[model samples]
Target: MACSNLGHTGVTYTGKEDLRETLYELCQSPTITSPTGGDNVAGYIDGTEFKFYKSDNLARPAVVNALLGKAKSNYATVYTNRADALWIKHYPKMKVKLMDQLKPTEGDGAVGVTLALQTVKKWPRQIAAIALKAPIPGGGLHAAAAGLSKDLDLPPGSRKKGLARALRYYMLATYSLVDISSAEAYEGLKNYVGALLVSDQGQILAAGINTGSFRHAEVSMLLSYFRNNPTATKVPENSVIFSTLTPCKGCTGFLSVTKSSNCVIYFGQEDTGKDGKVGKKISTQLSEKTKAPVGRSKEKLPGEIVPDDTEDTEGTGVVAMGTASEIHKVQVDKGLTSCMGTGSIATQIGKAKHAKEVLRSGSEALIHKMLRTRATDAESEVKHAVLTHIGQWLGTSRSVE
Candidate 1:
């Protein structure tokens, strides 16, 4: 949620102090004097005081605020109260034509792909919020992504190029750099992207440039830029900071499996030697910590926001086999797994929660069974009633199974 400082009527008052100061300033403003001299001076002063008092009372900050109401408006109207209100002026909307072009035909795979493309192409600004990954929507964003491979006439392992193209378009759209349909802009886009991808500045460039030719000096230049500002090899935990050389045990088997056999520990900015540190022999997993200040130990306790989304067992890495803390670590690690592990989000969502609710309802293993099963009229009515009840509790209109 974005916060704003000013209110309507172009007033600069935010709260108590600003309101008082504004009122004081208004009071000290130039006063009108009587043209008729001495006799009318007192009357003029009285009239001025009355007018000032009336205006102050009528436009009192509390009253002005009460009339304004909570903003509760759409994104377009959201940032009007901020000090730098004009910054919101440049925000672009989803291109209506591009969106119309993506309208689904019978809602099949092509439609899905078109929708994904349209979505990414239009509001590329949203990509960061959703995380900088492929915008594969329902039925898999990758399914349509293959179209790029076919369109480019590339062979296997050419998916990355298509992915890169999509990413380039996405970045440009997000920054409002240029319109995608312009041919010259697209060509420039190609060169710019080529430069960024193989450059040391890019994370994927290091692993991807083995096959491409070296004619493009832009690629090498980018590689040099990345080398200078090398991407961090280690991502910090969300909530907690891992102190150097701390013997933090793995919470679960998955925690142990997620890390490489050798872990690299950096203290401040420098990597120091910790004799016989766990990273030297075996991989050590660190649980996420709060964003500092919460625990104050630099080490956050378990349950900090995991960097990765929990999806399923397949890519869940190995579960740690140790004490309760180890098991807890595994549990936390599972939360870091991606949601794209399996076919259905419902199933994957359950796995993300460790199948706990599913097991409690005896619905974990029964997912397939429930899908295959049919309902009688009476059962349907009862299910509808139950769904309604649950929906009321959840403040949703979701159908119950």
Candidate 2:
């Protein structure tokens, strides 16, 4: 596939297969303070972090990131982050939209197009405490989300149906990028996801990405972990599962059966047609709206400091809040940290002994097992902090209990 950026046609994709399916994900970022001293260029995927000198080299170091197949995902972050540094402004990359098309060839003429890169101008990432990707809401949030719990008044006429709908259902939203292929298998490098299961009070439960045996669906693997694992099974029924992409009907049904109230998908709705345009279009619209973080808008609820409705917009990345250690605790460090609400988070843990064995045995199939363990911890640390802050914010902002 030919990739053209800024209207400059350059670089044909050099790979065996082009991505057949449209991909999506949700990026729940912990708000980091802008680099304090200077241009401190760093990037992290999953738990691994990379530092770079040249902005262009940012993508080169991302070889360690598990979810990103090639250099592009990290590269996009670097490109956008560095651009923000240079401009002295925050510009967030909302999403990467891939479009495939056929162009003229010399002799064989028509070639099967595999992959093309498109940068969505409006999908922003924030230091989110509770980011539910295209998530299905739990009893409370689900009721709120379905416009069942309360009356929702949306702005009228060409206001973007998605933006209004999201605001009506939620106070916050974020996004992610994914690589989709025709084959329904994980090929070590593509068609996987990064997942985290977190409670409303901010504790890590289970986390995994589509790796090893998990090539096709992350939601299934996450559900399996929650159901089968001794520790995760105890997660509060009110807890929510976060996935980088939207879950299929089967997986969503499974989540429903498991009694887990919410499964927030970061990406798009599943496609109804064979061509897959409908879902992709909706994803694009939602991402576009989420690219810029909504602030002090007319959407704010009465007597609230922040808006009643929080949505994303295009072209703005976020800075994480909190201290360096606090940032790193959840940002990079693995394995549970700090009590959430009840202070008995330690008791909430699954079998720590069994977790150690998974790490020690260290087989190929068990790679994701260890990954799930550590990533779950890492995501929980940050998410808890984020949730804690959100809780505090809600307390201070809302007069009623």
Candidate 3:
């Protein structure tokens, strides 16, 4: 195998070798599974030589020792997360460089992994195509603002503004991932929807996307949150969840059972069944079941209100002012969300076709629009927040110098 050096410190140029297969093998190997009873493994690739490491957890000494002892210079390491995504970390410094989720190409289980690997290996050059800088249609910022204003026709207030801002972030994150998926030639990129669990303070707790499987976007987001914060059993109170498309029945049920968020907001309504009616009904029922907090007045008093320092927002799933959380359905014009939801049925039909090209073009266009769009202080803040949330998955710092 010919390996080209990209002239960058931590970037590994493995000429035309799709390492997803090797990653899947290591993940399923007995060494990693026997010790941890889980399919978690790590691999280091130097030249044509591949070294596999097994660890029960991220901090396992055996894997660390393998990396420290064996890896010397110019190598790439890959690891599998709880979400079955393959993350490539450049070695020597050990910073995550890239990642791709293993799709069920052939069948549901391990067979899918095999088929996906084979598919990637077969079209290495195509998968390695460079991203094109394309123009976005309808003007990125203008379209986004117009969509939010028209869709979420709520009384002008902070809540409406906040929801609109969060939706922008969600759309950006979703399109960004789609761009990556397109670069990697992942099938069904158009059907991808992004989900975010955000705190009342506007910090993103966890970010997730639909894997085109049983794990919907909402479910994946919750899983990522719990994986990152193992001690957290449920979502924090006053936290909101934003989904690019309205969740299905399965996702709504999971969110309700888990008490996933105080408020659930969605951009595009799903065409299946009653649009967002089911989710709204379920969320309303949950909110009604929740009792008002004691000692806090449900109605606002006419006097100057002092912030309560002792108020618990941890596990109570209550909103401020002793009110229950609500579900909001934004009515977006035919836009990015609709584009994303298309070809989902095709994805379900044995991957017969995908919307990768459409999604990639759309994503690039949106990105271009965003770049050309004038940036307000608030827009800058939202962009920074989105970058920070994505940075959690893609490491923030470069590999150790």
Q: Pick the candidate with the highest TM-score.
A: 3
Q: Model 1: residues >4 Å from true position, as ranges?
A: 1-10, 17-401
lDDT for 14 (candidate 1)? 30
Candidate 3, which segments miss by more than 4 Å at Cα? 1-163, 175-191, 274-277, 280-358, 361-401
Estimate the overall C-alpha local distance difference test score of candidate 3. 0.38
List model 2 lDDT by residue over 270-377, tens digit each: 233332342242222123232212122122212212121333111222221222222222211022213212222211112122211111111111111112222133
lDDT by candidate, in order shown = 0.20, 0.27, 0.38
Provide TM-scores for the models: 0.15, 0.27, 0.38
Worst 10 residues of 1 by lDDT: 112-121
Per-residue lDDT tens digits of candidate 3, residues 1-401? 33333122343435434532443343344434453455344444444434433333332212333333333534344333332221112122343311134332432112211111100111011111112221121213222333443454434333334335444444434433433322222345445555556555545566555554334566666666655565665677655566655666656756765554445454333434473566665432111111111121233312221133333222221222211110011112223334335534311212322233233233333333344334355544444343344333323111101
- By TM-score, the better pick of 1 and 2 is 2
Q: TM-score ranking from best to worst?
A: 3, 2, 1
> Which prediction has more favorable lDDT, 1 or 3?
3
